[model samples]
Target: MNLEETYRSLGLSDAEYARVRELLGRTPNFLELSLFSVMWSEHCGYKNSRPLLGRFPSEGGRVLQGPGENAGVVEVGEGWALAFKVESHNHPSAVEPYQGAATGVGGIIRDILAMGARPVAVLDSLRFGDPADGRVRYLFREVVRGIGGYGNPVGVPTVGGEVEFAPAYTGNPLVNAMCVGLLRVEDLMRSRAVGVGNRVILLGARTGRDGIHGATFASDELSGESEARRPNVQVGDPFAGKVLIEACLELRRRDLLVALQDLGAAGITSSASEMAAKGGVGIEIETDRVPLREGGMEPWEVMISESQERMLAVVEPERVEEVLKVAARYGLGAAVVGRVADHGELRVLCGGEVAGSVPAEYLADAPAYEREVVEPEYLKEAQRLDVEEIPVPGDFNAVLLRMLSHPNLCSRRSVWEQYDYQVRTNTVVGPGADAAVMRIKGTKLGYAVVTDGRGKWCYLDPEGGGAATVAEAYRNLSCVGAEPVALTNCLNFGSPEKPAVYYQLARSIEGMSRACEALGTPVVSGNVSLYNETSGGAVYPTPVVGMVGVLEDVSCHATPGFGREGDVVAVVGASGRASLAGSEYLEIVHGRVAGRPPEPDLALEKECADRVRRLIAEGLVDTAHDISSGGLAVALAEMAIAGGVGVEVEVGSGRRPDVELFGEAGGQILIAVPGERWDEVREALAGVPWQIIGRTGGGGLKIGGFVDLKLEELRGAYGRDLFAEETG
Candidate 1:
């Protein structure tokens, strides 16, 4: 290929090329062009979503480190802190499911480790297309296997996460990974290389040609020929990853490093340039000094290869020997590949020759586009569902059975069974719960975390859907008796150049930010994965929120299952106000994906959630779960199925039975209290709209005297296997 083709193939526009030339004030070499190509791409530069992301509330009392870091850190309690973040590997997962997902998990772990914390737990949120399709089924299996393959061996507990299936993800699946780590507040690390003349170390894995142009590749749309892009997906080594985690944490413990950064996306170019920019200094990297796994790799190849299981850090010249000694003891590759310089320019050297040089600040700051978002005509139509015209099911019992067995609502036991969730023994409540609660070992304090999003809702109403996403996560944490603190997110959208996609992007951010401000759960760190479009169309805007809540005492949290037969069941807040818009029942029974999702009342949401947390803290509630998705009826059935018992509940007092029974309105919670504390339940929920539905009991589910089904039948439908049905 010629020079122009080479640069264009890297996803850089001609205008951007001209800007690079202007910055350098001269014609550029291939090395300089490669550097700018990946550094300025959407993956590294966040050229499209950066301005929109600024709308999120990113400040709170617990946030120690916010955006621009490898991961965000929040103080938990008693001199301990938690570092967490969520990142997406969507395009790669669609192209090469196994390696793409494995490396995604590996990448997020390194991010947590870079903050000088011991990696503790992992959670993932996945979205796939119609499960009945053979290709989508294959992708689902391989992706889950890949997640378990890497996480199980790394000794990090693969706890709880959510998976949903929809047609919007037919050819472009999203695999977003989240990792949580524990660290003493004093041991927190930063990526700012403060001192000039400090030596930069390349630790762990070696550079190769495996994942060249990965950042540019990820920033584009997929097609039927996406398989041809498989080589752009990096391979992962879980064993090497586990060792690197240990080696890096050991380095931090010994205070042998001044700064650390994980080598991901654009690899060396992004890591070095970003560190230099953040530190307000310069970095000079020698490609000849970099350890390589392949022969005859070009200078640009070494600079941009997205090799897996690697870290970049800087240390004082006098402490370099100790760092090298730690690397040697761990049986890993390490080399002094660069040095901090006072020139304020990122200079590339190879075999004592200059290959490229650019101002670090200019390289890190890409031009942000201010796109005008025009609401789509299709969205206006989609939001115009006439609820009164839609037919309600004749048999509520049969409808409940169908909703339970639907692919979107079935049990995920087969998926979570593949993961090793009991590793490290910190997990108090793992999968099959509202949130995964992990203890702080010797102390009574703990933390709860969950990943949640509803793309179908976002497709209907971006603003309301976005706000509801944050609100649902907040309520989910509160159900488990944890106080919501901060969150990390993965905003997956389509091409922002498209007016409709930009509208979804902007409105979703605006909505979620407002919710964050209301709930006081600020965004700390996040990732934006765009261009999730195939020839079919853009995927639904999926803004997955990874929220963390703090627990004052680990031993005192509520599970989402009935513990006693005599427990009294009650619905709190606005249960009667539940509506069927953007609900699973609407799609499954009526075959429509229309209508606005429930608009969350942020003020009322926080008040109700706080009361629920108080109930759990005071030992007045036995079980708690939020009403979402399938709404009141499905929530009751799930609690019964989880506890292996039957429940008889009287619901749907005066409203339409179907909407009251299955509507997915926000700000409502279901809690079961001991029979004797019914008075206390009434007293605690005095200010909110609440009602005592019924009492938990016998061998069947009796809902509002209309829907009645055997517990055996309910469990059977809930556990029905979609894969089995598809294959049969």
Candidate 2:
């Protein structure tokens, strides 16, 4: 069956078919069909999600550029605006972790670069199966390596990210990458196919056969046999991508182009068609005019190929030569493959013969598809379970160690150490901090950044999941001593028409809205990627939230590491019991996976986050880390390991030792305050629940009324077993 047949099967109405036929002529061939499928697929097409995504609140005086283009931009003083975006590469990573993850990093960077911004930081939210599984291990290693390999080489800091493991993700691992960039508000680039009689230039990598039907590939479900579909995977060369970014940003500043877009997804065909359609103009392309990396390529290969490091530019007719000269100066490939036309038809010529022609709008505007929704059989069962019986390990100490060692809770230093996070001195607090801190030159103000998500929990409980992601990001920023000011998100989910999926999707949005409203941090901008499914089944609902906060004193930022020996240790905020709803502890350490993950109490979260930020700025808190994922035990252990010192703790009277030490609770922070400032610290948190849990001292970690472990032992849980494999 050809592409047209598939659309017909998708229940496209006669009007839609006639519109598509008008673009490709009488009857469409395989190539034309493939192009149609890609342009009309939900991912590139947004057939089902466009309506829902339109509901997000994206306008604000600070919003320099919102949603429709590459990444969102919001002004952040100092004559600067921040550009950032979060995106998912689930199917591809599950198929080929390394390259898939590498390209994901590559793509997001290009998005920021396309807007004339300099990428500053990158963070990833990863989900995998049990590490014991050989396949999962391989995927994990490769995916981490790929992210480090690409991001490190590009000189962008891979600062803060989170990892989680669950059985539900075994069949489809999730790799979501978010990139943040800095651009002068005045220099921001706009994407609209404007200007009449302009020259259309294809710049960067030459057209090739790679990812020939990639957009269609994304639209369909992944069969178990993904190895056979390697051809659909787009190969990445980060070095080339880095060069392209530099060239593009430089060229944009020189004012040599009218409009710009990165050639992603459906490649040349989609970019050109969408650009023209958005500008209400037509485009005429000569297939033979494209620059090719390999010979013997067909016209379709030139149009649909998803080659990396390529961009499209609409240049003023007279400035075409100047644009070509600038591209040449950068030693990049440049070609004028088409011309903007006054008519509204996509006219294509192959060696002077009209090979195909179509209405630009029809090819670009996919028919809105409504999906069948059936509640999953497991939803009710998942919510019906009683929480009173949630199990707590008898030997909580051993459990803490196990949880720390688990891939999800362990430290990510091994993965990020390979990255040069400090290359740009603007980075005040690098990878080890809760959020990546970068100084805004020429001003005392600085920015704190973080990205977060949890797919399984979000899939099971959309509202809670969505709220948790936003809260998690804010908590991270709080730990770094910043008050979150703005948020952006990349919503990744399965088919929206499925009632269960739509249910989750809608609740997640509601959750986000509530969290943002409560926190006083508005949603600046974001992107939505729906229809992320395979033949096996739909992926768990994954929504990544990227948030930025402000800190006037970058130098006072707190980190999750030990700062001084003999510093008094304190715990602030509420503490109760661990929620296993979507915890690695329940799924991995124990053979149980029931209940719900802890939900954030917006009121308590604000109090805790705000208080901690104040203390850090006042120089009363030496070090701090929010209690999340692995809870208090993991957070404390991470702090000790990072400081290369040990801690001694005395469990307070009333609270359960096990719960106080290992329970997963949000709105709580572990801090190391110098003895001199103990009184001041106590005064600062007056009227709020507080505890003098212990003190940081030389040597190993010691806990009273709880099972004990040495600081070195705790570090071993996250130091990585791979290091010994090579060192041994």
Could you tell me every candidate's TM-score relative to the true structure? 0.99, 0.92
Residues 155-262, candidate 1: write the lDDT tens digits.
Answer: 999898999998899989999999999999999998887699999999998898878989988999998777898889999999999889999999999999999999
- Candidate 2 lDDT: 0.77
Off by over 4 Å in 1: none
RMSD (Cα, Å) for all candidates, in order, is 1.2, 3.2
Task: Output the number of the TM-score-best candidate.
Answer: 1
What stretches of model 2 exceed 4 Å from their correct place? 1-32, 370-375, 384-392, 441-443, 495-497, 524-537, 577-581, 652-656, 686-689, 722-728
Q: Which 10 consecutive positions of candidate 1 have the poorest summed lDDT?
A: 719-728
Provide backbone clash counts, one per model.
0, 7
Per-residue lDDT, model 2, residue 17, is 65
lDDT for each of the candidates?
Answer: 0.90, 0.77
